[model samples]
Target: MKKNQNFRFEKKNRTKLKIKIFSLQIMEFVTHCENSESSTTSSIIPEMETSSQIVELALSVERADTAALLGADESNIDTLEKKRLEEIRQQQISQAKLMAERRQKKAAMGMEERQNWEQEIERYRIENEEVEERQRRLDIDETMEEFYPKLCEWVGLSNYEVLYNSLEDGTNASDLNKKICGEKNVMFIIITKTGYAFGCFCHKKIPYPKKSYIYSMYDKKYFTFSLRNPSCSEPIYFKQKHKGKSICIWPNDEKNFIFTTKRFIKIKNPNGPHGTRSFFHGKFSLKYKSKDHQKREHTFFTQTTAFDVHRLVVLHWF
Candidate 1:
């Protein structure tokens, strides 16, 4: 009976050992399952974060495109608005012009307004004529604009008409007499080859010349001036002293034709090829250079006693 009891005790201990081992194996299996679940959750969390980031980038790009589209729409709208305003402005101008044309046509068709229309036409014609005349005068003045003011000051007149130009008209004594004789308030401008410009103004009418070597007259309102002189910086002027035969005319002699003033100056053979010899004395003379044959020093209004005439102009001062 004791042997039987020992065998049963051994069997019970073996069974208890086997149960403990089985329990340990179950705990290890549960630990392994937990580790695998944790690894899967970690990997899935990273993938979820990456996916969320990608979605956010896509949303940002969409927002940018939307903003860009909105900006483009606003720009297009502004451009259309400007074009519409410009078109409206042009239409308004056209309408205004059409209305004016209609009004003008209506006013011109009425019979009672015929006289008024005719008067308006006459006024317009007069205005046009005045404008043309003003332009013509301006053109003429521009020809002598350089020294016109000085000439006007010397003649004591603001208005004048060029009557004769030797370059334009024939350089003859008969040509000068035709335009100048019997004309009052006449002026003479003489340009010399040696760079001297001088002139004289006569208040009395130039008389017709007689059949003689020299014809002369007297006038108190006669004066002489040197516009340009090599020796003088400013213009030189001289008034008549005794007023004795201040105007001399030559009618027949073309080559020897000249103008002279008694006790003042004598321009000999003004149109001659040998040039002219002027003797300035008393009130009309000044210390000047000479261009004579002997090169004699002379007291005159010019640098040279003998000078070739470049241009001769006669003007009627008004």
Candidate 2:
């Protein structure tokens, strides 16, 4: 009996110690459940509000990104328009330079053509002048050959020497005078045996008888005469009177006589002694005889009386 009671008491003490350790583990599990339920109930409304705020911030960020993309597209369109305008201005400048260069080339070609035409004209003028000079020289030589010989023959020159000698002497001069006098009909022809020639008259054949007169007054005597043609109606005569008993007389021919009275004169023919009567210068004068008057006065006093007068009259008519 005693051994059985000791074994039972020891078993009961071990069972009570295990039962206390299990009760402590159960109390720790119940405290953890109550703290988890309190934490979940307190944070439920605050969590919902924070989630709604985050969704609104995300939508605002998306709208800002879309506006930045649209601004970049507008800037690219403006830059493309400026580049196109610059390209059009550069093309217009290039075309203007090309037209200016072409105009300069055309003007230079026109000036060269005008200079060539002037040179051709000058060359033609020089050639024409040379041809004219040659033709002029030929004409002068032909004219000299055709006319020179005929001119010499017409002047009656067999040679130049005969013409020169005849001109130097006076023989041709006298012949020329005879030809001129014959042509004018002023020369009196004398048909001699050798040839025809001329004659002159004696002074007694003159009709103005007063040429042989002498004048006397107060013991002084004077003689007078004149030169004229007797056949002409206008005869020139000179007269004078003497104081002494000297008589005035004149010759009518080689053997004839004329005597003066105061108012009348008597003319005797050469063949007879009988005289004819004529009036004087209205004065009564007497006639006397003188043999010396026949030899000295009648032969030498006459000139070639009518030759110069005929020449002057013919020239006046011509």
Strongest candidate by lDDT:
1
The 10-residue segment of model 2 with minimum total lDDT is 309-318
lDDT of 2 by residue, 150-264 (tens): 4233322322211111122222222222222212111111111111111211111112233354322222222222222222212122233333322233432323332222222
Name the runs in model 1 displaced over 4 angstroms.
1-143, 213-216, 263-300
Which tens-of-lDDT digit does each residue in 85-133 have in candidate 1?
9999999999999999988888777755888888999999999998774
Indicate the residue-level lDDT of 295 in model 2: 16
In order of listing, the candidates' clash counts read 1, 14
What's the true lDDT of residue 164 in model 1?
88
The global C-alpha lDDT for each of the candidates, from Candidate 1 onward, is: 0.65, 0.32
| TM-score against native, each model | 0.46, 0.22
lDDT of 2: 0.32
